[model samples]
Target: MMRPVQEICFFVSCGVFLLHGCGRHPLEVDISDIEETVHVERFDRELFEMKMDTADHAIGYFYERYGDFFDIFNTHIIHIGPGSGKRYPSFLSMFINDPANREVYEYTGRVFSDMEEINRCLTNGFRHYLYHYPDSTLPRVVGYVSRFNQGLFTVGHFIGVGLDQYLGSDCHYYDLMGIPRYLSKNKIPEKIPVDVLYAWATQIYPYNDSVDNLLTRIIHQGMLHHFVDAMFPQLEDSLKMGFTGEQLTWCRKNEAQMWTHLVEKKLLFSTDPLVIRKLLEDAPYTYYFTGESPGRAAVWLGRQIVREFVRRNPDLPLGVLMSRRDYQEILRESRYDP
Candidate 1:
């Protein structure tokens, strides 16, 4: 966890503070004294509210608030040109004036009219993040309209969330866009914190190993999930794993069988990208497992191994666990018989 972007993990080893309560789990710590909170800026609203009469000042203020991210939003996110271009105002006007984008923006507004619940959720999770890394700053979260381009994106210290991508699984737009039901299952308000924390966790502990084998990647996935668990101790495993309750149950009931398959098939150490994708990508179900199993079911096993590793090694700090690179050694010591 001592990487460049993770330089903020100054006290990550000291195990500073966490959110503890009466009858709280041991994984949680006391964070009542931490006065920090997360404030999410609505970039979508500001973009839509930009009127022609006062477009110049509105653009100026938006630029001030978003700065470099403005260009990122336009070029990378919305597929528009750079925000600093001379024709940027016209580009923004075109986006605002487009009837289709307008519809999406209106729908997003109706769905996310009240962000209080989400703000509070982010604050609590980030508070735990801050508690562990006292020197880190809470990421500046901004909500935007990605027109179904992406669900979320992280750059530098800013996190962007697309309101349109999360307008309920049954939203007509998703149907119109031809999104699969299994993929759309995660398009809900509740997945925001989980998604955000996972994105941040990747940044905190990016996978840089040149050896991209199945075991290496699988354990990395486990480490990321473990980090998210530490940030939100009370969160349901289904939400964290992006699995339906039934899918999670299937994973639990067949954990041993799945482990046997991986080892018996000699697929645990395969470096084939296609094999890795089959095991890890989001789909109806993991190709290697039955249809009843969840996509990335192998990752669930990875998390279990990591959980066992941490459980067996009580004195190991979270930072150390995450910083670890010897995936095979970690798996061996995990003693994860199940």
Candidate 2:
């Protein structure tokens, strides 16, 4: 939450000056000495290996190993009801027996057979997290194949990453499942850590604003992306923002024009859910902009605003940057004026 406010405000200032973030940037520091690491549990492999013959033992084993997440996955994710309910075994069996689920799980093995690289990346990312917020509890990461039901999800201190969802954009399964090109193109291994940290950032510092407006929503989204930036400093903005290389280039070239459109059209403070969705949601492009622009283009501006805010306030710790909730005050402080 605090991190995102920093992200949101980073844009307010950056957006004003043709996305030039004159403010303090999130420092890229040496984290080689940080000992923190994250290891993802292979829950997907374990779940797929469950056999009815060993039902009693396996059931107990899952309960002991995964605890609340076991029940949550059963109820909230796969939607098979509570884990301990009488019909739970039958439902789980049905899921395991499903041909489609089996196909997806098997395919996941081919793509993620070795998770060492992923573990190393996450370790480095969390090292940054520890560097910034030493008091926070690092969430346990559990890797699972959800038959494309979830890309990433969080409850309490565990983060579930759906292996099936990140099986590369060109995976035939996506075409088979009718996944849109714009969406599926981002389903690559490189995006996993960024997506994971972003999800965790949202959970730790959720959108806590009292009023819902376009500016607030855009700033919140920008802050979330900034949190990801802090965690993974080297990640490309296009990947972090889920835009194509060309799309990102377009955003930079037209930053001022986009900001002007928002101002002249008087859309910044508007709270219409439709307007929010059109600007923030995934689509081929932002309907408000030329077809050459990418979806959620406004958010790109938000990121610039926050980047500037953080840049200008170099001395402010990340926690303080994110803790700032006054979106308007952030804007005023950012001095963002496209």
Candidate 3:
């Protein structure tokens, strides 16, 4: 979940918590305590409706309801125009008038109008976070339509989700926008909590150093995946890995060959950012080894290494595992020759 820029990140995990509630009316004995469920606060819906309706207090409403977040959107999401050397009206003006963006905003609302499922997933994942790190402060979750500019981002105590980005993969607009189908397919409501929670995880368990090599970069993702697993224990691995069923099966079948290729090519320890990007960054395809190979093969390897590390150190708690920053030591200890 670590942002590629400046932001605090953290993880969701399960450990070290207990709750009990009971009552008896004999001589009087009772105890009460309730764990709160985590959920997203829907400022996006209110903001979109206000813009659409041209409400009297639209500007004031945004300023008052979202406070500094308004400034953030202006700076990051909306101030710039679609092309270089061009300009657009302020975010508010643009949102109020753009026809296509308006449709996207409405579609986003229709798709996510009922966020009970999202709330439940986040609540459960957050409980796991609370279970492991009892003292951690939960971020204030909010929803917003970002015109597909930013999917999810966090700053200070706020975690903002760009609802438009997750419209079902089959939505025709994606094709119009030239988004390849493979990448678009994962843009579903089901993946929202994982993205948000994993982003939070990066805030907590940040990669302090720059990733200069394939091993570090992929291991960074692996750690995030591992943390998400602890947080959303019931979620499928494919969802966590952002892999299709066939992609996962391919990775599994070729795990050894993949590792062998990395070693044979001397890629693991090399500090080449370009090499790292080809293996770890999202793309239509990596196109390095085989055309059929999935992109981010390094991620699969990193997950395999972390799994091996955990297997070797079975007693290490999730908290401890994340706190350790020595990737080289983790790799060495993992004995991950594969």
Candidate 4:
């Protein structure tokens, strides 16, 4: 947390503006050296399939390879089943050794056989992070097939990637698994870098304040999204916002209307948790708005407020903004009208 605030502020002021190259900040860290420093472990291919012919040998290999994480691995992957603990041995055994699951493994194999491009994206993303925060802690990236349990998560210093979650949107496995179409749409390779970076960002700068109001929750998520956006400048706003291109367009077109609706309803400063969830949480769509309205409208609005706040204070560094605890102060300073 300290590193994110200190180093990011330092980097912002030093004049290194990537993309447009307009900032006065100079990059302090060498991008080339980051590859050697941060490592991404391919546990999916290397461990899961390494000795699949024999579970005993596979178990032994895992125990030796990840002695430090054997307990967590056992709890999350082996002992507990996807999304929960295994209740039936037959079900668990099928998930591990069934011919169909093996087919699923082979399916993932084709998609992830060449992780060169993904590795490069992840490396670049981490490099950008290190560039801003030189002393930032690095996580040991572990790629595993979670049977579509969790998408990606960080356990201690290890970032666990569930490879099965990215088997393309149209992959038949998703249909067989009964995953909703909307949920599987983002399971493409390009989204992996964002997922990894966002997961790491949340670990480094988690929301510490209470979420008693709609505005508070939005600003909190807005801060995280802003950090990720700065790190991945090339990613589209829609992708970072977790919206479709059309949905983003709808938001922009109706930005004024959405703001006006919030104001007319006096919902921005309201401390109603239900109201907060309606606007901020993920749903099929925001029910208050038209069906065409994108889900998570509050997050989008919060992002706008944050953008305006930064725009109004060009001299302010991102780290300083993140470090500030006064959400109300930020909103007031932003003078966010729309």
Clash number for each model: 2, 22, 12, 6
**Better by lDDT, candidate 2 or 1:** 1
The digit string of per-residue lDDT tens for model 3 on 281-324 reads 77766646577777886788898899889879877777898887
Instruction: Arrange candidates, best lDDT first.
Output: 1, 2, 3, 4
Give the residue spans of candidate 3 off by over 4 A.
1-34, 51-68, 80-91
Q: After superposition, how far is residue 253 of candidate 2 from its true place, in Å?
A: 0.4
- Give per-residue CA lDDT, model 1, range 161-231, as digits (tens): 88788777777787788989988989877778778889988987998667889988899999999999988
lDDT of 1 at 241: 88
Candidates' RMSD to native: 8.5, 8.3, 9.6, 9.0
Query: In model 4, which residue pairs have backbone atoms overlapping below 3 Å?
Result: 14-24, 14-25, 14-26, 15-24, 15-25, 16-25
lDDT of 2 by residue, 184-254 (tens): 98987767787889999888889887788989888888888888888877666776888988999999999
User: What do the candidate models score in CA lDDT, each in turn?
Assistant: 0.82, 0.81, 0.72, 0.68
**What's the true lDDT of residue 206 in model 4?**
73
Question: In lDDT terms, which candidate is top?
Answer: 1
TM-score of each: 0.91, 0.91, 0.82, 0.79
Residue ranges of candidate 2 with Cα displaced over 4 Å: 1-26
For candidate 2, the per-residue lDDT at 82 reads 81
